[model samples]
Target: MQIVIVLSLLFIAIILFATEKISVDIVTLIMLIVLCTTRIITPEEAFAGFSSDFIVILASIFVLTAALEETGILEFMIARLVKIASRGANILLFLVMLISGTISAFMNNTTVTAMFVSPLMGVSRKLKFSASKILMPLAFASILGGTCTLIGTSTNVAVSGYIDKAGLAPVGMFEISGIGLIIFVVGMLYMMTIGRRLLPNHQDSALTEEYKMQKYITEVLVLPNSPLVNQLVYASDLSKKKFKMLNIIRGKEKFLPDYRTRIQANDILLVEGEIDDLITIRETKGIEIMADVVLEDALQSPDIRLAEILITAHSNLIRHTIREIDFQRRYGLTVLAVSRQGETLRTQISDVKLKLGDLLLVQGAQERLNYLRSNQHLAVLEEFSQVLFRKRKGIITISAFVLAIILGSFSVLPLSISFLGAAVISILTGCISTDRAYEAIDWRLLILIGGMTAFGAAMDKSGAAQFLANGIVDWLAPFGKISVLAGFIFLTVFLTQPMSNAAAALVIVPVALQTAAALDSNPRTFAIAVMLAASVSLVTPFEPSCILVYGPGKYRFSDFLKVGSGLTLILILIIIFMVPVFWPL
Candidate 1:
């Protein structure tokens, strides 16, 4: 009965996750609560996952990555990449994938992917290449690259921890690197050859039209009979409707009108708002649309509005409140919108807190705009004219990261301590700032991992894992241990597509371990198979890396299913074949 209850809860969690009816973190927490309330697992056991080393490591890594971002280090590296790859689009794409994949091998793949999206989009646009072609490749490269190292992804670290907990010798970093290298090679080859051809070549055009804001700016004349003749600008639709009253030209005196100033007859008000809405306002508010003057002038002289600006690490805008920035005053530019990771900011953009990699849609003087590229503290992502700053900090940051890897790999220090120490050294050496360090860490992801870790414990302690494993073992007894191992791997890979990779791994690892015990085979082998299968989900664009590229690539959901499904199939076959060979039953 406990087993049935647990399975039912698990099924419900999966459904909730698939439908996104509730947040994944919430779903995981609810599962834990249900398990504990029903006495399926002890409260202590249900909460053990919160104290797991995997959570600690993931949290620390977020802080470390956050520091790197704050110091403008990633931007510096991308700038250099763009300068070196000035050859052509094909070479640029290849180099970008190569670099993105290589970096993802050591860093968090999502963070690495996020750092590159803006620059990659800018580079693609400047080179007159389709962003859609490069973005998907970039996302795929990060996913493939993550397979190369234990620290490459949280999934890898979680699996390793699980192996140690299950009383098996943990796999060395290079043990999986061999197969990962092969996968990377095959994946990159496909991207450069056939995959590139399959991508859509959407033509470059201004994205502003998508917002439907073209009709917003219009001019109005204060007629003598207007009721608003003696009223301040704030009392009229210009202020009420959030239109910027740019200027008033009376006779030959062109003056920028203050928002609080009153209007008079013959004064022209340059306002911005939807044309239909403005027409309605004019009719209702007793004002006349300056169609012959403002409309005709706008039609005759089409002004090009472009904004160039730097994204600073310490800007209060990072991850909090965009509305607080008062961007119009702080930057002297009107923010039409913002773009991040190929996804346009869909919220009330003016109120959204700016993150480090955000690309602002600004409108200001072109001359002053170009100056933003030279701001070393913030990356002027779209401008390629600026020289890349190869400051000494790059060496310091790289060395610190390398030292951490060595210490962790050699067991000279615990993986958590090694990274923490490296992060400290990087800060002290001026490689990254304290503010940036904080921004670099992904707090939401950390919370999700921590919460899910506890959920995993609940699954294990409830006998849920054991019961499921036993049932599966009984069902597949005729096929033997290898088939059982294959079944587990296939099950995990499928689960990962609909749910998060971490959640899927946490769900499957316990069952796979239990099954391995029943078959008298190596539990570590089964655990590793589950780990690899869960992390290598290339069959959908739901992953963060994939979502980052989805909008920029102009890719349909079907595109990923079409191309990524085949890749997933190949990966599954490889895992099934390789896990047995490396850790024999």
Candidate 2:
């Protein structure tokens, strides 16, 4: 009965995770409640994972990494890459992967990817190459870099914490670094060669053509006899008809229209609206449509520029429509279009509610666009300036982080204490503020990790892990222990598509450990295999690092399947064959 109950809950959890109707953290918390209610785990046991030392280590790393980012040190490094990339496209691709991969070994892959995305976009635009050519590779390198160390990814730390609780030695900071580096090198090579050809060549087209908005914006001259003359631009017939008054030209004066700006006879107005509505307005409102217009001329001026803003998961703008956002009043930009997955929506874009990974094509003054860079609400994928660096504080943050790593590596202090102390030092040195530090941590990911750790305990407590392991062993024992390990690694890779890498790894670890024990194989070998496998599940853009590039790269879902599928298979083969050599089965 206990096994049945646990299996039922596990089945339900997988479905909920895949459907994504509710947040993953909420699903995890709800699962905990159900387990506690059934007495599968006591309240103390259910919540114990949150209090583990790893939670501290994980949270501290978030702060330390954020401090480094806030110092603009990462941007400074990327700025140098841009200068070097000017020589050639191949050099640009190679340098981006190399630098981003190295940094990801020490920091969160998502943050590392985010730091590089805008700069690469700018680089690709200037070089006149397809952003699709490099963005996917950039994301892949950051992810592969995380396999190099225990602290490289949350999945590694979570698995280490779980194994430690199971009475095995926790993974050393660099214990897996040997095999990890091999994987990173292979992945980098694959992305550079075969994966390069598989990558789509979606050119960086102009915002108007890319968003399908060329037909939506045009100029109309206000006739002398029009009743709309002398009316405020914001209150005119055009505004009532949902036409966005972008710019107004009266005589020789041309400027962005304001609420107070009144229309005058013979004034030429640049407007954005549906083509059908625009045509009707000309007949009904006494305006003359201009001759064939250029999109750049109608939308941009000396003061106005075009850019894309990525809606991050942490962004407060998610779930809110552009109409509700008041982009003009708040960020001083107009929402011209929204891109999600691979589709672009230009019509009714203002009414579309934003979601994680949505790319917004906007038009605004350069200054206002730069302000979006400092705003935590949106990731502006445009001009990045390294002028915000704090040289002294940046050096201090680096010193503190290195000192922490050394102290922890040598066992001079507990790893958690070393990192936490460094995080505090970063704050004291003004590398990052207390509030920004709090925001830096991915609370949902932490919650999922902490809560799912308890679920692992429940699986053990209910003997669900044993039951599943027995079944797997029965099916694969004939082929040998090596086959069993391969089975678990493949399962983890598949599971990571819908669930987070950390969450997927946590779910599979217990079962793999139980299977190892049943077959009298090395449990540590199995545990490490499952952990590494989770990080290499690059068959889709479900990973956060991948999602950050999904829209910006103009990549289709098929693009990942076409490019990442081959690379994921190659990495899996490397892990499967390499694991036994490192730690014999």
Candidate 3:
């Protein structure tokens, strides 16, 4: 009955995760609540996940990564490496993947991809290369690189913690590096050779059109008899209809409009809204929609500009529509359009609920855009031309990070303590503020991992893991030990598409460990394989790193299928053969 109850809850959790009606963190919390209420696990056992060392290590890494980004140290390093990597398209792709994978082994893969997306866009433009060719590789490299270290991804830490709690040897910092390096090399080679040809070559368009914002922005000439001609700009029909009047072009002089500014006859008003709204105003107010004017050109000035911003996981805009939030008044910026799940949405943006990974085209003051760069919610997609690097802060924070790595690697301190200490030093040295540090930690991810840990405990205490493992072992033992190992790897890769990599790995760890024990094989081998398998999910863009690039790369769902499907299969084969040799399953 206890096993049936745990299995039933697990089934429901998987369904909820796939539908995504509720957030993953919420699903995890609900799972915990069910486990405690059913008495399948004690409240103390159900809550033990929150206090795991894995949470501390994962949270600290977020702080350290954010501090590096805030001080511009990570950007500087990437820029220098990219400059040296310039050659032809194939060479550039290889170098990018190589460097990206290496760095991803230490940093969060999403943060690494976010840091590169804008600069890689700039590099692609300079070389006359298609961004579609490089952005996918950048995202893919970061994911592959994460397989190289225990700290490279939260999945590794979570799995290690589970192993320790289950009375097995804990994973070392660099224990997986041998097999991880092989996978990275194979992945880079595959991308440069066969995968490069599969990538799309979408031609580059202008910055405004690139974000598909042209149709939403329009220009109109104010007529002599227009009601808006003599009225304050804030009270005009355009503002009433939610059309943001970006600028007033009076003859050759361009002026930004404010509440006090009044429109004059013959003034050309550049505005952003649905075309239908602009057309309605044009016919009703006797203003002519200037057909020949370039909307992008008129929308720019020394003070006002256009850029792309990504909706991050922590953004307050999630699940809220633009109109409901009164976005313009709240952020002092106008959203021109939005890109989501590889679709460019130009019309009815106000009605669209914002989701994580949505890229927004915005027109605002340079100052506000700069402020948005530091905002945890919105990620600016264009590179800031001005260097904000603080040399002393960068040096101090970097040194602290190195010290933490050394101490953790040499066994002088536990990995969690070392990283947490480094995060403290980073904050104390002023590399980033206290608020920024708090914002940097991906609280949702932490909660998801923490909650899942309890779920794993529930499965163990209720005998669900052993029951499931017995079924798997009976089915696969006929094919031998290698086949049993392959079965777990296949299960993990399949689960990752519907769930987060960390969550999927956590869900499967208890079962895989029990299966290994049943077969008298090395449980660590099964644990490590499951960890690596979660990172090898390249068949879908649902992975956070892949989602970050999907819109910006202008890729289709099929694009990931065509290129990533092949890579995932190849990596799976590599893991099946390579993992056993290292851990001797």
Candidate 4:
């Protein structure tokens, strides 16, 4: 009955994750609640995941990474590297991926990708090559690089903590570096040689057309007899119809409207709304829709700026639509459109709930965008100025990261404590504020990892791991130990598409450990394989790193399928044969 209950919950969790109707962290917590209520796991067993040492290590890394970001260290370093490598497209791309990949091995993959996206976009324009060419390789390299270190990704730390709890030897800092280096090299080589040819060559287009914002935004000349004339801009007919009045052009002056600003005769109002309704306004008394409006001329002025602002995983505005947040009033920036993956929302963009990695095509004053970058956890892609660049702060932040790694690697301090200490130093030394430090941690990811860790305990407690292990061992017993390891690797990579890398690996590790025990093979071999397999999921753009690039690179679903599917296969082949030799299956 307990096994049935756990299995049923697992089935439901997989479906919920695939549908994505609810957030993954919420789904994981709901599963834990069910498990505890059913008495399948004690409160301690269900909650043990939250108290794990790996959780500390994971949270500390977020804080440390954000400290570096706040100090403008990583972005500054990347821009310098890009400038130095701008001699040729081939050499430029190689260095971009190499530096990004190496940084991602220590930093969060998403952060590394975010740091590089803006600069690379600029670089691609300078080289006259498609961003699709370099961005995809950058995303892939970051994911592959994380496989090279125990701290390279949260998946490694979580799996290490789980196996230790299961009574296996703890993973050393550099234990998997050899196999990880092999995976990185193969992934890089494949990306440069075969995968490079598969990338799309979508040329950079105008910001308005790139995000499909021109469908809604346009210019209209207000006639002298218009009902809107002499009315407050905030209370005009356009406002009632939900047409966002972005700017007012009278004579030669271009100004963003406010409550004090009133509609006047012959004023050209720059507005965004449903395209058909905006065009229909020509028939309305006293409105003339301007034909063949060049959006660049309407939107850009001496002080007006257009750029892409990314909603980060830690953004406070996640799940809130543009209207709900009063985004314009708060940030003084108009939302021209929001791009998710390859789909750009131009119609009713206000109703589209924001998600992590969604890019907002915004038009605002230069000062306003700069203020947003300083105050918010958002990235402005076309204009990412390193406003917080302080020489001393940068050195201190980098030293904290280095000291933590060195201390933990040499056993001077436990891994978790060493990272925690670094996080504290970042806070104390004025690198990042206390509130920002807390906000920098991706609490959703931490919850997903922590709650799913408990789910692994439930899988063990309910005998589900043993049951699955028995089936695998029975089926693959004749095929030998390598075959059983391969079975688990296949399961892990499949699960990663709909699930996060850490959650997928956590779900599979227990079953793999049980299978290894049944086969009397080295459990470490199977554990390491699952960990590496979790990061090898290039078959889809579902990975956070890939999602970050999807819209900006203008890649299609088939682009990832054609290029990443082949890379995933190659890496899996490396894992199936190479992991056993490293850990001795």
Say which prediction, candidate 3 or candidate 4, comes out ahead on TM-score: 4
Against the reference, the lDDT scores of all candidates come to 0.70, 0.87, 0.86, 0.87
For candidate 4, give the lDDT: 0.87
By TM-score: ranked, best first: 4, 2, 3, 1
TM-score of each: 0.83, 0.94, 0.92, 0.96
Candidates 2 and 3 compared: the better one by TM-score is 2
Clashes of 2: 0
The residue pairs found clashing in candidate 4 are: none
What are the per-residue Cα lDDT tens digits for candidate 3 across 1-585?
999999998888889998999988899888888888989888898878889888899899999988988888887887876676556676778878988898899989888887777777777777788889999999999999999988999999999998999998789999999999998888888888889999999876666767656666778888899878788887887788887777788998886666678999999988777766766776676588886336577677888888888876556788899989987777778777788986778767879999878988888888988887766567787753424777889998888888998999999999889999999999988898999899888888889988898899888989999999999999999999999999999999999988888989998999999999999999999999999999998988998889888887888899999999999999999999999999998
Worst 10 contiguous positions by lDDT, candidate 1: 295-304
Tens digits of per-residue lDDT, candidate 4, 354-378, equal 9878989888998898787665468
Best by TM-score: 4
Model 4, stretches more than 4 Å misplaced? 213-218, 290-294, 373-376
When sorted by lDDT, best at the front, the candidate numbers are 2, 4, 3, 1
Q: How far in Å is the alpha carbon of 336 misplaced in model 1?
A: 3.7
